[model samples]
Target chain A: AQTVTQSQPEMSVQEAETVTLSCTYDTSENNYYLFWYKQPPSRQMILVIRQEAYKQQNATENRFSVNFQKAAKSFSLKISDSQLGDTAMYFCAFPDYGGSQGNLIFGKGTKLSVKP
Target chain B: NAGVTQTPKFRILKIGQSMTLQCTQDMNHNYMYWYRQDPGMGLKLIYYSVGAGITDKGEVPNGYNVSRSTTEDFPLRLELAAPSQTSVYFCASAGADTQYFGPGTRLTVL
Candidate 1:
């Protein structure tokens, strides 16, 4: 079984600053996908960024990026120029592309507070 | 487009009762998913559908059921509700790799 772990249960940062959320996973598969989904106060889960394990370069999306260390099974999210609206629960997910029934395995999440 | 919409933003039911959470998508997506998020936790997949007439159990499907009769709609059914079933349910529709989620249904089983 693949497990995604988010060690930081809660995090806070001043508005316009940067914050990094830690995530690690245990998977034997060499090829797969890692994702970061943000759930805002509205309870809408939105995809922030994604990275393919086969790629060495980390993925970046606007102000959201991921530090994907395939060898160490670590996929952390970095939020830059954070805004107050960025406050939410961020989940690190892994999609078992190696399986027939591909399902997302998610971490417990890190509740982020972008303090104004 | 409405993307994905879940009916009854909030619902409460008694133990042993039954109810179906409705989900519909307007983007003509082929894949739909049902997930539950407990308080202060992440979302867990309950069920998913590849297409119409094809549904499969996910990580936490023991206490839930699902059916997909049309490409636009997928409904999750709870035959016998329990207190443990109290959680926020999310419905999502995806095309290829990116998934679009609904506002979610907050369900409370008393």
Candidate 2:
């Protein structure tokens, strides 16, 4: 079974500051893909960033970046220069293609509040 | 392109009623999925399709049903509505490893 865990249920960060959200996963598959999705008040799910297991270099999309440690099975998201618009729910997901293809296992999520 | 779209932005159903949630994608992706998110929880897979006429059950697919008759449409059917079925449903289409999602359908059962 594949499980993604997000320990912090809620978090807050001041504008222009940096905040890191923690995530861990348990999967037996040697190769896979992980993703971070953001859901704002509008209820639209947006892809924030993605990390491939085989890559050693972390993935960065503008102000969003990931710290992926394959050996420790930890994939954390860092938001640099956070803004008020960054307030949303963040979910860490892992694609479990075991038998059933393209099934994503998602963490409970961390509600992030960006205050000015 | 309209990536992915779902019909009925909001719906209210009574117990024992039946309804189908419509989903379509213009990206021509081979993989489509239906997922539901309960309050304060992450999304759970309901059903998925690899392509036309190839549907499979997902993690939480007991009360829901899905069919993919074409490359662009995957509709999920709810045979009987229940209070537990009240949640937001999302449809997504995958191209490569990335899945693009819809705005989501909010369904409430009274």
Candidate 3:
């Protein structure tokens, strides 16, 4: 039971423009670990960028980039140029490395608004 | 290095009352986690530990109760509180795979 699907609940961009927040997961485990968390409003929970499903390259951190498509299990999160502090609440996590109390499966967030 | 720390950043109970939500970690990470973030949703796993007494049970562990006697402490117990157990409670620690958060604990059960 490894599920993480963030179908964009809310998103907006303008500052510099360029936002892509969408994730999908069901995992059958072939090596796992993918994250993108950013919760502003002081609730601190940063750490935006990480994808390692045997690594196929996709994974940046400067402007945050990720498009891992492990056989379509998809894991997208790219926000380039966008500023305005990037207005937070973006999450798409997974840590079900076959599970053993590794716990970390979230997805139901995407409320970014970088309008200005 | 206050890597992970969760004390009483914010708390308010009433339903049945009973508290204990404090986590600490100086980065001696061996794995420790307990999550819950309800408002807008996204983050639910109520217990974990892989060092010190070894505790487990995630994906929402009933009412909740945890303890990791060492390796930097990991405590989360709410014997009778309800209201869907309010929300906003995060405390994590892990070294071999990224995970270090703790600036959360906004429980409120009225």
Best lDDT among the predictions, by candidate number: 2
Estimate, for each residue in A1-116, the C-alpha lDDT of model 1 and write its tens digit.
78899999999999999999999999888887888999998888998998988889999999998888887899999999999999999999887665425578789999999999
Q: Candidate 3 regions off by >4 Å?
A: A1-14, A18-30, A37-52, A59-64, A67-77, A81-87, A92-102, A105-113, B1-14, B17-35, B38-44, B47-56, B59-79, B82-84, B88-108
lDDT of each: 0.90, 0.95, 0.89
Ranking by TM-score: 2, 1, 3
- TM-score to true structure, per model: 0.94, 0.98, 0.34
Q: Could you give candidate 1's per-residue lDDT for residues B90-109 as a string of tens digits?
A: 99887767677899999999
Q: Evaluated against the true chain A, what TM-score does chain A of model 1 have? A: 0.95
Cα displacement (angstroms), candidate 3, residue A35, comes to 3.1
Query: Considering chain A alone, what is the TM-score of candidate 3?
Result: 0.34
Whose DockQ is greatest here?
Answer: 2
List the RMSD of every prediction in angstroms.
1.6, 0.8, 13.9
Q: Ten consecutive residues with minimal summed lDDT in candidate 3 chain B?
A: B37-46
lDDT of 3 by residue, A27-60 (tens): 7889878989899999889888888899899989
Candidate 3: tens digits of C-alpha lDDT, residues B1-110: 67998999999999999999999999899899988888888887788998999898887899888989899999999999998899899999989788979999998999
Better of 2 and 3 by TM-score: 2
DockQ for the candidates, in order: 0.66, 0.87, 0.31
